[model samples]
Each structure stands twice: as C-alpha cells, then as structure tokens.
Target: MFSRLANVFKGIFSLFIKDMERKNPEALLELEQENLRKQIANFNQGLAAHAGLAERLMSQVRKQETEERELHARTTAHLRAGNKSAAAQNALRLQSLARELEENRRQLAQAEETYQNLTKAREVAVNAARSKIEALKGAINDMRMKTAMAEMNEMAAGMVSTIGGSGDTLSRLHEMVEEERTKAAGRARMARDSMDMSEVNIKEAEMDALADQALAEFAAKEGIALPGAEASVAPEANRSMGSNPQSESQ
Candidate 1:
C-alpha cells in the first residue's frame, strides 16, 4: 500500500512537471540548451584527456625511434672495434626497442583515429541540438502571435455582435435623437403659424412712409429734385391747365 501511494505521488509530480513544461516551452528549451552546454564542456574535457594520451603515445614513439638509432650506431661501432660481446648485446637491445617503437606507433595511430571520430560525433550532436532549439524558438513565437491574433479576432467578433444587436444603447440613442428632432421641428412650425401678420404689416408700412418723407425733406434742403417729386409735380401742373380752360370757357 505504501509503495502504491508513493507511485501515485510520483505520478502526480510528473504530471505537474509536464504541465509546467508545456506552459513554458521557452524555459524548457533554455534548460535543454544549458544542459547541452554542460555536456559539451564535459565532452571537451574528455576529448582533451584523450588527446593528451595520444600526445604521450607520440612522444614515446619518437623517443623509442631515437633510442633505436643510437643503439644501431653503437652496435655497428662495437662490431667494427672487434668487441663481439658488446655488439651482440647492443643488437639485442635495438631489436627490443624496435618492437616497442612499432607497438607505440600502432597505439598512437589508433588514438588519433579515435580522437577524430569523437570530435566529429560531438560536432554532429551539437549541431543537431542547436538546430532543434532554433526551430522550437521560431515555432513558439509563431504560436504566441497566432494566439494574440485569435484573441483579437474574438474580441472584435464580440464587439460587432453587441453593437449590431437590436435594442442596444446606440439604437435607443438614435431613436431618442430622431424623436426629439421631430418634436423640435413641430414646435417651430406651430410657432410660425401662430404669428399675427396684420399688425406687423401696418407697422412696416408706417416705417416705410416715414423713411420716404425724410428722404424727400433732405432732397428739398439740398436743392436736389427727387425723381418722385418731379413725377408728381408734372401731373399736378397738367391738371391745373385743364381746369383753367374749363373755368375760362365757363
């Protein structure tokens, strides 16, 4: 029972972690990138150690080669000096050195090949990981942009639905404005129709007569005959002449 409960708790924890990873993919990607860096550092350290081994092997091979040459010269010199025992011993030592040099050379070759292969493997793995990280970054950005656009579209759709619905605030406002405008126009028409024009016309005519009298007096004082005065005087003069003839005849 305890084991089962522990398993259940572990499962819950795993689920929570997975959910967090899903929600914050960039964080997870950064974590992976950091892990990749650490792995690369460790791998490089190991590669350095391997390179050091190869260098040691190379040094050993070179040293053995030099020793082999020196022994050969010593053996030849001993034979020329008629010391058979010294020559034989030097020849035997040279043979052993040759064998050891050959083995070191082979080991060096193998180590060099192994180092190259390891370097290539590291490059391939790191490149693959970096490419995946970049791809994920692009995908995450695209997702965020798409999500924002979707939210905006949904908000716009909601606004359109609300504004276009009947009996909404804008519709009521429009109706109220039209009703008030019609009422105002009706009131104006009624006011215009209720006005009495007879009194106003009489007053207007009196003002016009007063203005004409003032103009005529001004023209007489200035000794400038008005056109209206000339017309009236000519008609009066003709009437008087006709009356004089009548009176003479009578």
Candidate 2:
C-alpha cells in the first residue's frame, strides 16, 4: 500500500516540478497577483485624495485667519479716529471675520484628523498584502508541481490521461504511478545484484567489465543471471489492481 502511495506521490510531484520550471500557469498566478495589487492601488488613491483635501482645508483656514487679523487692525484704527459710529460698524465686521476664521480653523482640524486616520488605514491595507502575496506564490508553486508531475507521467510509459471512452483520470494516474514504481523497484534489484557480485572479490578484470558482459560470460559457461534478470519489466499487474483516486473519491 505504501509502495502504491509512493508511486502516486512521485507521479504527482513530477507534474508540479514541470509546471514550476515551465511557468506554464503564468496566467493563473498573474491574475491573482494583479487583483491584490489593484486593491492596494485603490486604497492608496483614496489616501492621497484625503491628504489633498486636508491640505486645501488648511489653506482656507490660513486665509481666513489672516483676514480676521486685518479686520481687527482696521477696527482699532477707526476707534482711534474719534469716529464712534464708524468704529462700531468696523468692530461688528471684525467680529464676523473672527467667527468665520474660528469656524475655518475647526474645519481644518477635523480634516487633518481624518487625513491621519486614513494614513494609518493605508498602511494597514498595504501591509496586509504581504501575507496575501506570499500565499499566492505558494499556491502557484503547488499548482506548478502538480502540472509538472502529470507531464512527467506522460513522458514516461505511464498513461498521461484517461479521457478514453471507458476510462477516467484517477485510474490512469494510479496506473502511471504504479508503472513508475515498478521501474524503480527493478533498478533497486539490479543495484543489489551488482553489490553482491562486487563482494566476492572476483577477478579485477572481470569486475572491470560491464555487469552485462560478466553476466553474459557466466551464462555461456554456467547458468548465471536469472532468465530475463536484465529486463526492467515492472509489476504492471500488481498496480493495475489498485483503484484510481479520482474513481475512489467519486
């Protein structure tokens, strides 16, 4: 069972590696990244607008404050002219200017407060994208790995797809995985045979030759390597018995 799972993992992993190398799914990764960037851009624009408004409001307050100071100065000059009626009128105008300036100052203060709050919000929004970007990258990598493994299976003797009349994808995936596993197991057996042959301290010349040459020479003199021992025929039948995950899940 573990062998079967190992095979499946290998098959799946190959697809992922291929995708990563090829950057085959660039569209998917780009689309997600673009979405996050757009949101951040929108937030920045709002913050910029808010800051601009605050600046404009402060400028208005400065102008009104200056006007209020000038109106008071003029009213004092009228009082010193010994014109009581004119002085009274000037004083009333000065009071109105003062009130307008005070109101403008209040508005400027509120605008500044709002701008500060927006600055903080903008920081928070931009900071939030860091985690989102990382997550998107990881998701893309994972998808790439799967796509690569699938392609590898196609290149190998394994079935790349099960889109045929009666078969399905999951079954085909398992078949491919098992096929790969058997090939691996065959290589393992050959390595073991070579190790055993090396231990006997056979003639250095004999060992120098390829294993195939030594095996052939021994076969002619005596039955050496088992029949078809060189054949890397994997146990396709054993793996054929396993069910495909796609079907199992269904």
Q: Which candidate is the best by TM-score?
A: 1
- Which residue pairs in candidate 1 have backbone atoms (N, alpha carbon, C) closer than 3 angstroms, thus clashing? none
State the number of backbone clashes in model 1: 0
lDDT for each residue of candidate 1 in 147-174, tens digit (9 for 90 to 100):
8999999999999999888968998899
In Å, residue 198's CA in model 2 sits off its true spot by 39
Cα displacement (Å) at residue 126, model 2: 1.6
Error of 2 at 160 (Å): 18
lDDT of each: 0.95, 0.77
Q: Candidate 2: where are CA atoms >4 Å away? A: 1-26, 142-250
- Residues 132-230, model 2: lDDT tens digits: 777867887887788789888776635433344247867788899999999999999999877865556666656667776777788868955556653
TM-score of candidate 2 to 2 decimals:
0.46
Count of clashing pairs, candidate 2:
13
